[model samples]
Target: MDNFLEIETSVKRVFNSFRHEVDGILDRKLTGGEFRVLSLISSGVNRTTDLSKKLDVSASHITAITDSLVANNFITRHRSEVDRRIVVLELTEEAKEFVASIEQKKKEMIVRRFSVFTEEEREQFQELLKKLAEN
Candidate 1:
């Protein structure tokens, strides 16, 4: 129990640190939730229902995030061709470029953060994270 609690605290601290770094890198252009939604959309998770399920968020929450993305020209929605009742989300060309840039910046940041670790240590750490995620 104590070990689990320690792990949880460490995870929270790491997540908070990463969020702060990314937020600064993004210049506050989007919230973490918004960025996550956009990233998922870019990865082909389009429908609001799908996003809600994937993110474990409410449908209305996804709607609000999509609304902001639409307003910023980051993404656009259209009715699905096969099902008019279903709306699909897509990233605009500009948004694609923006996301790519953001991804590059994030990669750079991660590389910098992990620079102190040896290659084997980093690989082991990644494996451990994957194992935890699988659980």
Candidate 2:
């Protein structure tokens, strides 16, 4: 607790715990990376390059993830009408439904997990996390 390394490890453990919760909520239907890409696409990040930059991964990695999503019928890739060279990603109808369902489940899980914290504590914790993330 006194050392930065210990704090870092604790933070990592907390992240891992959340990831595990998400995995359970997803029922192993999607890997964490795939879920992330889908979430970003749903939020209107529709370009592979943008996704790569946002996720801080290589374009090739995005391509691979998109390929998997495509094969699973979770997304579609199309050429931009204004720029044929540019690829745009979009969620399929099935993906939209899936996203909604998963979001509900995640919300429930978050509520259950954070129930120990009062509203003010949760708000303060979120603000602290935002500050740390910004720095």
Candidate 3:
């Protein structure tokens, strides 16, 4: 409604800056897509097909991302006990710790960034963001 491109760019910058900041803190790099996949897996979307569906990506695309995660020792893939055809993905212990650390850092960063706003303002901002995100 108001310079849509500007709003889009600003949103992109916010996420990219957070990722960059986290990358610096961790002394490593991860693509936004990779981090998202890790987050989803951590949150209980374990099946490969399910992840593809949730992310709206193709199965092969998910596999490529998971393959890198596996190679990095961040995740492990196994066949479902009940259904060997389905591939289950789990974060390695190291990945759990890594994700926890990243979450903590992100929480602190967001808190600091939003500190300038009053509590009511923060709540309104959150609600507005959610409204914008609604389908």
For each candidate, what TM-score against the reference?
0.91, 0.93, 0.84
Q: Which ten residues in a row have the lowest lDDT in candidate 3?
A: 23-32
**Which predicted model would earn the best TM-score?**
2
Among residues 3 or more apart in sequence or in different chains, the pairs in candidate 1 whose N, CA or C atoms overlap within 3 Å are none
lDDT of each: 0.95, 0.95, 0.88
lDDT tens digits by residue: candidate 1, 22-67: 9998898999899999899999999999999999999999999999
Task: Go through the candidates in order and give the clash count of each.
Answer: 0, 0, 0
What does candidate 2's lDDT look like per residue over 14-117, in tens digits?
A: 88999999999889899989999999999999999999999999999999999999999999999999999999999999999999899999999889989999
The residue pairs that clash in candidate 2, if any, are none
Query: Which candidate number has the best lDDT?
Result: 2
Full ranking by TM-score: 2, 1, 3
Q: Supply candidate 2's per-residue lDDT for 118.
A: 97
lDDT of 3 by residue, 35-73 (tens): 779989999999888999999999999999999999999
Error of 3 at 59 (Å): 1.5
Candidate 3 lDDT (Cα, whole model)?
Answer: 0.88
